[model samples]
Target: MDDRLSGYPDPDFSLGTLARMGSSRLVTKAHSLLVTDARVWPAPDERLGDTVSILIVDGVIEQIGAGLQAPDDVPRLSAEGRVVTAGFWNCHVHFTGREWSSAATAPAESLQHALDDMLLSHGFTTVLDLSSNPRTTFALMRRIATGELRGPEILTAATGLTPWRGMPFYVKADVPWVLRWLMPAPATSIGARLTVAAQIRGGAKLTKLFTGSYVRPDQVKPMRLPVARAAVAAAHRRGSRVFAHPSNRPGTEVAVEAGVDALAHVPDETEGTETLLRQAAERGIRLVPTLHMFASTVTTDDGYLAPIRAALGGFIRAGGRVLFGTDVGYMADRETRGEYEAMRASGMSTADILRSLTTEPAEFLGRADTGSVAVGNRGDLTVLQTRDDPSPADLANIQATIRAGRAIFLRDSPSKHTADAP
Candidate 1:
């Protein structure tokens, strides 16, 4: 293993080793035992696996597959009939925390806590906080890493880059003024790019930009291609990926041309052309549909989402990468709420939805060691209460959230069991 990635202890230092180290207190087990017969998704070939035991040891997956006896000293959880998968990732999010007036400028500490609570409660083990003042964002992330806060893994950009006047105003009250603050002056964008470089210098895993116009969704004034290119190039040079927010066809085209690693959202009202999607596929770019947020807000009145949905379906059919995400601002009641709904509404299959929420986004975020329930992945699992077709209400039914190998969210609600089970 490369020295940089060598920090994790040897796998042999498994649960048994930790117990011997007097650190057994750090290890925990799943709350309720689930002994499911088998769980498969995405037609089973897209990295889904067969029956697995999925032992959790110190927040990491210690072992997988059946018949591995839990040590007599350790507690056992038999989750028969309950499917286990990696926690979800919301790749596109805005951190305004929970306050109404000071949300945009909320203290990073407060926002990180609330955001962590929301994501963990919703079963998202990882989140790429798309837009934030990168300095503060990284500080919060540092806190999470140091156990100063409790939350999912946070990946963030220093500040989103866009022309000084065209940024979106998502925060409540005086949002327009906040736009003025977020817009990229040549100096500001340069400073922001430097901030991004600093983040890379300081160990940021990714970067973000508002490459396309946010002024008016339809009247797309794409960011200057050279400027867009520069931001992405600089980030890429630093071993950090860049994500762009583009909300129109022209803007999407610009993002693709600029070679941004990911798009925070595809064009609204305008469905992507096959050519565009194909080009994006060829470039190995990723798309965060943020379908739920769009479905709930922007596409609500005009019915503009049908084409977006169809476009996304085409993209999926074309084997383009898609990640699950919801654009959330603090204090919003429905933050991170519409992923499953939008997937169902868009006619995505259960398997596809599961992959989008799990493996797909995890892979995109460069977290190959997470997302799947496997031998060495992080033991972050979300166990829903049922195997039946979930209703909209089921969105709230996260029976348990296992972080690392420990149960973090265990629901006391009744479960309606499915027929196909252990």
Candidate 2:
């Protein structure tokens, strides 16, 4: 055993040891405040014209309107002409890496820096971690909920399900053997159901299925329909949604047959691609266009890129819901400009893009009180330092991210000392 592992009270323990080592930094919020003078988008479809005031009390939006005055005792922050919208959501992300698993045990500054760089700095107030070690992910969520950590609302899928021999070759070639425990492969339908139930019981709000996975550069393997169906049934019975990684047509068919709630990627735009996407949309299967993931991971030409763009455009035209996700942890590109550019090129309007980042995912997650800057909603917001009616590209100009009325990531500036100071 490594010297570090030997120091743990239980040398056999994994996440437990890491959690104990880093439990000292947990600190909860101790106050409330008001924010004024901001151009607020009250919802994806409604924008309150410039200069609105929002009252946040006990981590909820107490009131919102123009020319509202703050209470004498509460602290206030002035947005000073910035654009404020409902907190952004990255519906697809992964909490993989030493920094993430051991965040609780890391130095406060280091953890904060890592989190800001990965999610917060990008204005993601809520993120769905599609794959990660359940123990560490849940522990991190608990810390955030208790205000021990300044980060986003994390919904984890826990360990994702794959066929017994279906681990993607790309992943198998890279991931260490010990970390393979995070990706469970069940060979039988009963095993799949058991895996789903176990994950839900282990604090997972959602489940992930590798309906299709790449075995080699040209070969793709898909989970058996029975296994997929069983997992989906178990998840739905447990009141959780299921996301699927549809590697191609076969995988997509399995996902559609299983009635998965969301498709984790935009499949290859091959023959009948448009028809398949439209059919999936009709079935109410939402798509998370990790368009950037394809652009970054695989070597591609204009021909390949065009098909993906067309497929996504066709799905949107068919009235399919789209959610924002960049595949950040897995892809290594944290900045969202390329994604915005790709979506824009695909004929996605700025409103549609914004909805993907806010309303859509929140509603999908049953978080009606979030994804909007409405009274009584959670006071989660993303403030951007940009002109009014900013485009998707302007999203990169994030000024600060506020979760539950507290500023979790505030860009450094000479005059912005107090996050809640008016």
Q: Which is the leading candidate under TM-score? A: 2
TM-score of each: 0.75, 0.90
lDDT of 1 by residue, 1-422 (tens): 21211111222223232223221122223322323343422221354455556555555666566666565444345455555556767777655442312322446567555654566667777778775544345445554454445556667664566654555544213333423443333334466566556546544567777666556534555677767777777788877788877777777787889898877775674655557766786778877777766666654653677777766766667777777777765225445446676667666766666666777777676678777766566766776555544454354466566666544444552332221111
Q: Relative to the true structure, how large is the alpha-carbon lDDT of every model?
A: 0.58, 0.79
Candidate 2: C-alpha lDDT = 0.79
**C-alpha lDDT (0 to 100) for residue 85 of candidate 1:** 58
Q: What is the C-alpha lDDT profile of model 2 across 1-422, one tens digit per residue?
A: 23222111122434434344233343345346678888887777886467878889878888888877766877677788799999999999986655664544656676667788989999999899897655556567766756657788787787688877888886676555565555678889899998888777666788999998887878879999999999999999999999999878888888988899999999863555567788999988999999888988884577788888888988988989999999887888889888998999999877889999999998898888998888889889999888489887988779888888888888885435566442
Q: Model 1: how large is the Cα RMSD against the reference?
A: 10.2
